[model samples]
Structure formats: structure tokens, C-alpha cells
Target: MDLSRPRCRLWRELVLVASLLACGIRQASSQIYITPDSLIGVERYSSSLAIENAPEDVQEYSWHRGANDTEENLIISYNATSHSRRDGPMYSGRESVSIRGTLRIWRSQLNDTGNYTVRVDTINDTQRATGWLEILELEIPQISVNTTSVVDGEDAVAATCYTNDSHVQWYVNHAPVSSNYRMTISPDNKTLIIRMFSRFDSPLQCGIEILPELIQKSDLVYVTVAYGPYSLQLRSSPTDFSGILSAEIGSQVEMECISYSRPESKYRWIHNGSLLSFSEKNITLPSLTWDQMGRYRCIAENSATQLTLYDEVHIQALWRRPVVSRSFTISGSLLVFLIIFTVLGFTHFLMVLIRALFRHYSTRANWSI
Candidate 1:
């Protein structure tokens, strides 16, 4: 004898006995039975059992309350009867049964989330089947910010959170923030107000968590803050010049003046006594001419601080007018002619004197001989 084979046979026999017991209960009652008559907070409807088979003796079905079951809760109900089969030659005790019924669910609640069962009975047997009902509360509420932009020196800004449900919580950086005196939540329990000390560029996260479930978070929002201008200074390129400053006519000359500050400043170009429209890091004279030749200035204006800066530049004309005086020209010409005539006369006089002396010396020598 194999011990394993005997054990398997015993298990099968036990299963058959249980199935027969379940069927035999239906024979004990003539009616179909259901559980709890009412349901709450349930979104879907279902039953424990769909069909119940009973013997022919069953006529009417009545529902009975079981332990842990209540009235007004959803359940399954039905009615059924059995008929015997007869033949002309012989009559067998074999019977066939037919069942007719309707199923329905009652009032539901959020806490009614659980498993339910239906019991059916006949003259000889009773049977039961199990099912589940689920209730969900999904809702989102309104949220808003107290201030869109915060001041720099301020410790923190506040944002108000709201929701339709009673379960409301505040979150920042995906973590919950303390709802203390610094942060004031609404009395209705639908709003979660928070104040943060740090300045953040990314969006802040806030949300509400209901019991046994999580609701959607509030919309991500960006907070802006305003500050002041840090530093202000002038900058220029090739900042050296010399000589009889001269620049070509009808040519663009660049005069760059740059300023670095926390907040950028506006630039304006001033020529002589007039203000020009060119405002940039570098100011260029589109076309240079004699009329544009003068002192040029670059002024930077910071609207936030109401401050102005000045950078000076000299624009020299390419050509200078020739300076001439009538009196000086006439005097210079006369002086040159007078000097030439005096030198010629002085040379002729010296030659004549030398000749006369030579003739006198020759006559004296002949007389003494």
C-alpha cells in the first residue's frame, strides 16, 4: 500500500463531503437569503452569489440576518423550486430545479468598504458566496498665494492652501511644513497657510492627504522677489588717445562706456549741449563731420537709484583751417627784397676800393726808381 496515494484519496473525499454539505443546506430552506440591506459611500454594486439551487420541496424564500450583518445593507436574494422526472415504464427519484430571482444593492457609505456574503437555503442544503464593495472619496480644492513677490529683507512669504475635504496639509519640497504660529491655517480646516524663510527659484509644492488615501497636490507656483543694484562702475575699450586729435569725416567713431551693476542701467549719449538718442554699451557716431566735432559725453542712468554717470570723449575734426594775417604777409615780402639789394651794393663798393689801392702802389714804386 502507497501512503501518498491513500492521503491524496482522503483529501478528495474530504472535498466531496464539503461540497455536498454546502448543497445540502439549500434543501433545508425553501427561500433565497441576502445580507445587509443598506450600503454607504460605495461607488460600485455587486453580490456574493448569482444563482442558488434547491430541492423541489422549497416554495418560499425568506432572508435572515447573520452575525456581523446589518439591515439596510446590500445583499443578494432569490426563489427556487424542484420538480421530479417520471417515465411510463418506471419512475426514478431524480429531480430537476429552476430558480427565478432579482439582485440589488442599498445605501452606501465611505466606511462600508469591506467584503460581504449572501446565504441561500433549500429543504436540504444551504450555500454562501463572498464579494467586495469599495467606496472612494476623490476631490481637489482651491489654493492661492498671499503675495506673488516678496521683499528681499522679509523673513518669509505666506501662501494659503484650501481643499474641499477636511483633510488638508501643507507641503514644501515634497515635505510637510510646520503649521505653527508663523503659519496660520484657516478655521474651516480647508486652508493650509505656510510661511517660508528661504528664497527659492523653483516652484513650491503644497497638498492635502485624506485618510486612507492621497489627494492631488496644489498647483506649482513661482515666487518672485525684488532687490537693489549691487555695484556701478564705468568700463571702456582702448582707453588711450593723444596727438592733435583728428578723425575722418563721414566715419563712425565708437565710444564705449560699460557699467556693471546688479541691475543694468540705461545709457545716453550727450554731444556738446544736446542729448542724443544713442544709449548702449558703445555709442557710435554714424557719420562724423565738422559740425559734430566737439566734446562728447556718455551718461548712464539707473532708474532704480536715480543716479547718473558721465564719461567724456573729445571729437577732433579731420582738417583745421589755415591761419593767415594780411599785415604779416606784406611785411615779410618787403624785408626779403631790401636784404638782397643791400648785399649787391656792398660787394661792388669793396671791389672798387681794392683796385684803387693796387694802382697807387704801382705808381709809387716807379717814382722811387
Candidate 2:
């Protein structure tokens, strides 16, 4: 307590300065140097923090997961002298360290993504390094169209490129797609909407672009256009356009129906005013007779467009009436003799009648001439 002892005061200051130097050295060595690059976790698994520095000077190794090193975030510690390791409660049986000081976490999920740091104590120095674990979204993506098929008109249709957490782009005919007034795409470039479609615009090729420079093409779904059966015509066996087909008695006549349609028209034959059982493009009448001479109609109908057309033809037989079947067995000579005798008898009767009239006239005296 006396001020006379100046040497004692100086000695006290020296001791305090030595203690400060030791503390400065310790603080400088404790400063950790972390790698600027961050680690990336891909898919459903992740990696853990492991001090890869295998220098013989490395006496101790430690790992932590926090902004600043603290007792709570201490994950694992290894002592080189004792050849022993201790794991904190956070990584109890799941965290492991290799003899070369590599930390690994097996079977990691999407949520196991964050910062990690390692503290190393070497023979010459003690320092720390920090890095990060980032899990990249690896969910598979999809591309879909709203309508499987459509009619060519002002109808609306849509397509979409889909993914869970990634951005995607759409392609048309192997090229990148663009949006316009009549056609629009969503802001995320996933949904494509079309207002109207043209006849030539059918079979639009749509696709999707995804990771690994891969492209997925779409199935062929062309828009359907509806039309009709046109240019309907009817032809007979002779293949002429006389409107009348001549057939010998008891002969066969074939008729063909010709037309064009989108989905092909079905043929139906009409005999007279009633429908026939035939439904082929061409028909045949097995036998032709005077009674069968009439008008035959060919009706062409499209099942898809519901368009129908009709044409008819008249059949004429060469014989006016069916040939009569005869059953006579008489000779020519007998037939001539009968004919002459009949004529002679008729002549004799006429002569007798005339003579009687003349005699009557003479009896009356006024007939003297």
C-alpha cells in the first residue's frame, strides 16, 4: 500500500503485459479459415462436414453446425492421441468420422440442408473452416395437353409443362415456343393456350425441355375436321351414263355406287320406293325380268359427318313380255290341210246365200233384168 515501491509497480505491469501477449496469441490461432465454396446436396441424400486435412500436425478435430461455435452446436470431436471420438446428441448414431477426418451423413432427406464448420488443432496452429450444404430439388417433371382431340374451329385448347420446384420451358416442333394474342403462355412458361385452330394447323408438335439437355416429345393428336360425301355417281355393267341399263330376260345386272367422303360413306341400295337389304358400294340383281324393270337408287351416307347423297338408274328389259312356254306337238302338213278346208267351206256358204237372194228378186216381176 506504500508508493515508495516503484520497482514493485513496474514488476506488476510486466506480468500483466505477458498475460495479454499470451491471450493475443491464443485468439489469433483460434481464428478459423472457412472455404468460400458451399457444398451441394442433390436428390434424396446429403453429405456432412468432415475435416479432410490429413496432416500429421493435426492433433484434434471438431465439427459444428451454427453461425458461431457454441457448446450446443458441437456435433463431433476426435482426439488423435487417444484414438477416440465423441458425438453430440444431434448426430448420435447417425454421424460418423473416418480415420482421415471425413464426416458423412447417410440417407439424407430434403430438409437436411444448412451450414457446417470444422475446428482443427494442428501441431503448429489451431484454426476453423466453414461451408454450406445446399440440397438441389431433384423431382421429375411432366408435360401435358388439356384436350386429347379437338374440332378445327374457334374452340380453345391448352398445354402445360409441369415440375415441383424448378422452372421449365416449352418447345413446339423442336423449337422454342412464343406467345401471341391468339395464343398465350403462362408467366411461368408452363401452360400454353390457343384460341382458334385452322385446317392446316392440325398436328401441332409440342414438347418439353428439362435438365441434362433432354427433350420429351408429345404423342400425335391431330385436330379433326368434318366434311361431307361429294361427287356421288351411279354406274351399271356397261359403265355408261345412258340412265337406263338394258338386260336380256332372266339376266344378271350389276350396279355400282361412287362417292367421296371424309370417313368414307356407306352404301345402301333402294329398289323402287322401298329399301333393299344390300349395303355394299356395288350391288347385283341375280335375275332380270319384265317385273323387275324399275328405278334403282344408290344412297351414299357418311357416318362421321352425317352427310348423305343419292342417285338412281332405270333398268329396261329387251323383251316386252316374258317368252311364253309352248307345249304343241303338231306337224306342219296337218296344220296346212286344216287351214285350206276351213277356207273352202266358208266360200261355198257365201255363193249359196247370193243365189237365193237372186231367185227372190226374179219372182217379183219388177226384177226382169
Error at 186, model 2, angstroms: 7.0
Predicted candidate 1 versus true structure: per-residue lDDT over 1-369, tens digit per residue: 011111111111111110011212233354443212222222222222123433345443322223322334323233454332112111112111125322222322354456555545556675554434344443444567666665344446656665555556666556665567656667755555544433443355566543223345778766654433334333322242641236778876666776643247677777787998776767656777788888777676656445666667677766678988666344877888888888888888898999999999999999999
164-249 per-residue lDDT for model 2 (tens digits): 43345555444555787777878876677878753444554554332223333455445565445789989888554568777787
| Residue 110 alpha-carbon offset, candidate 2, angstroms | 18
lDDT of 1 at 310: 68
TM-score of 1: 0.35
Q: Tell me the whole-model lDDT of each prediction, alpha carbons only.
A: 0.48, 0.62
Q: Please give the distance, in angstroms, between residue 65's alpha carbon in candidate 2 and its true position after superposition.
A: 30
**The 10-residue segment with the lowest total lDDT in model 1:** 11-20
Output the number of the TM-score-best candidate. 2
Question: TM-score for each prediction?
Answer: 0.35, 0.38
**For model 1, what is the error of residue 99's alpha carbon versus the real structure, in angstroms, after optimal superposition?**
33
